[model samples]
Target: MAEAARLLAQLIAIPSPSGAEGEILAFLEGWLRARGFPVAAFPVPGHPWPNLVVNPQPRPRLLIDVHVDTVPPQGGAGPVGPVERDGMLYGLGSADAKGGLVAVLLAVEALGAGQLADSPITLALTVDEENRGRGAEALARGCRPEMVVAVEPTGLTIGVAEAGTLELALEVRGRAAHGSVVEGGRNAIREALGLLRDLEALPVMRAEHPRIGQGAVTPLFIQGGERALVIPERCLLHLDLRWLPGIPRDRFLQEIAGVLARYPVAWEIVDLSAPFETPEEAPLVQAMARALETVGLPAIQSGMPSWTDAEPFARFGAQAVVFGPGDLSLAHTPAEHIALAEILQAARVFQHLLEAFARP
Candidate 1:
């Protein structure tokens, strides 16, 4: 446990923002090689750092997905110094995922080479999770495992499902006229305000999942009116979405078009991500639940609101879930910190999970 904490501290001290994770990548490669794990680094065409694959086993029993890159520090030197206070480890990436990363390493180390050989577990450390998730997309394209667990800050809950994301940039067009005689020209900015409220009431959004709940539609930005004295001809509305899983692409777009049919707006899909939910009876969830119960923790199942690497694997029929220590709300914040005990407990949980799969 003490060693795990120490490793997390070291990881937090390094600044590995999205595309510039070179130094940390080098450090991890050497560290894994020294520990007897043969590391395979795959070069991504435009990426400065390659995805590091530890244990390189194909279609293993357990595939651990971890992201090494973090969002840039919000302020003050970028979490360069580590502070331990009140049983919590304080650092930028401490909660986002460096803690989970260290815990996975500790669990594998304790499992020993003999057990790993029998279980055939693989660990893939990806990059660019905070930006575009290109690292995960690339990894998912080349690899397929029976089950993959994304070690994120889940506060130890077994995340069984996750909502997908769809970002839309709509151009709500209107006629231009003098601001004084605005009654003749349509006010697109005013119309956009109405769409914001109407979007939440869409028919597709009425259906709610037990864990993921009803989807969310939030307006990210609204811009209209280039000049002060004239009615704006165009208004741009950027929308952020969190919709339920299993909705087909064509149907999803059709539903959006249903709402915009009345308006003179032209919109396009700006960004999109797939969603997935694992059945409760799946072996992966069962194994995790049994392991958590063995460790005297609740085997609770829930849904993640944010997108994860698991989304990419869903297309390949991989059963994936998000699980780890620390509250996700603290992720990407300047005050990110996680309890030291959670790290130790999470490592123990992971060890039990590995043991369960390693068994016949």
Candidate 2:
């Protein structure tokens, strides 16, 4: 636990912004090497940062994956340096992932090489999980584990499912006219807002699920009004939509199409990450539940509110779940931090989970 605290502080001290995770990755590989752990450094195609995949197995029954990148640090949000005070460690990337990442490392160290040699396991420290998820995608293409644990901040609960995210880009066109003209053709921004309101009001957008909850649609970006004295001819709007599992894709599309038919708008849908759910009855989930109980923690089932590396692994038919320490809401915020006790406790949980999988 003391070692975990020390290593987590050291990791937080490092600046590992997305797309520039080389230094952190190097440090981690060296740390593992020093412990007699054989690590495989694989270069991610078309990316500067490379992934460190260790203990590769042929269709391994279990794979533990974590991302090395954190969101770029923001000024005046919180302490960029590590601060351990009153049982909490506050710093950049503390709760969001570095805490969980350190916990995984300690658990693996506890398991050691001897026991892992007989187990079908692969541990991947991937990159770009915050952005494109290309790191996870690359790892999935070659080595598809039957079950995967994509480590993220889930407050140590078993995350059974996650919502799928979609990027909706819209362009509303209108005739340009003088800003002060009484006969102004149309204001693209005004039209875009009305269209957005109607789009957000669709019943499909309100689809709900028990674990992950109701679907959501929010406007993320907008650009319009170029000339100072002219009514804009075009307005661009981007919407972020997160939908839960069981929401019929065809129904959602049909509803949107019906709405679009009444507007002068051009739109496109970019699928970001697919929603995934691991049934509680699955062996993988049962094993994790047993681990929690073994570790003296409640076997609570929950859902991941954000996208993660699990989505990519699930594409290859891997039963995936997100579980770790820290409050996800604190991530990328001024209050970002994690409880020191949770760090050690999560390590124990991971150790138990690994041992459960390693058992013959």
Off by over 4 Å in 1: 75-81, 246-249
Cα lDDT, model 1, residue 292: 93
TM-scores of the models, in the given order?
A: 0.91, 0.95
Candidate 2 weakest ten by summed lDDT: 243-252
Q: What is the Cα-based TM-score of model 1? A: 0.91
On lDDT, the candidate that comes out on top is: 2
**Prediction-by-prediction clash tally:** 0, 0
For model 1, give the RMSD to the true fold.
2.3
- The alpha-carbon deviation from the true structure for residue 307 of candidate 2, after best TM-score superposition, in angstroms, is 1.3
Q: Write the per-residue lDDT of candidate 1 for residues 1-360, one digit (tens) a residue.
A: 578778888888889999988878888888777777778986655677789987666577678898999888787543444788888898888988899988888887878756676666888889888888888788777777889899899889999999888889999988888899988898888788777767777766665878878888988898899757888888999998777876766777677778888787898888798788999999899989998999999999998988987888876888899999999998877678989899999999999988777777
- Give me the candidate number with maximum TM-score: 2
Whole-structure CA lDDT of model 1: 0.84
Per-residue C-alpha lDDT of model 2 across residues 1-360, encoded as one tens digit per residue:
578779999999989988989899989989999988898877788889789988876589999999889988887856986999888999989987999999999999999987887888889999998777889989888788999998888889999898888788889998899889837678888899888788778887776788877778788899998757888889998988776777666776678789878888898986556688999898889988998889899988888867898988887899998899999999998779999899998999999989988888
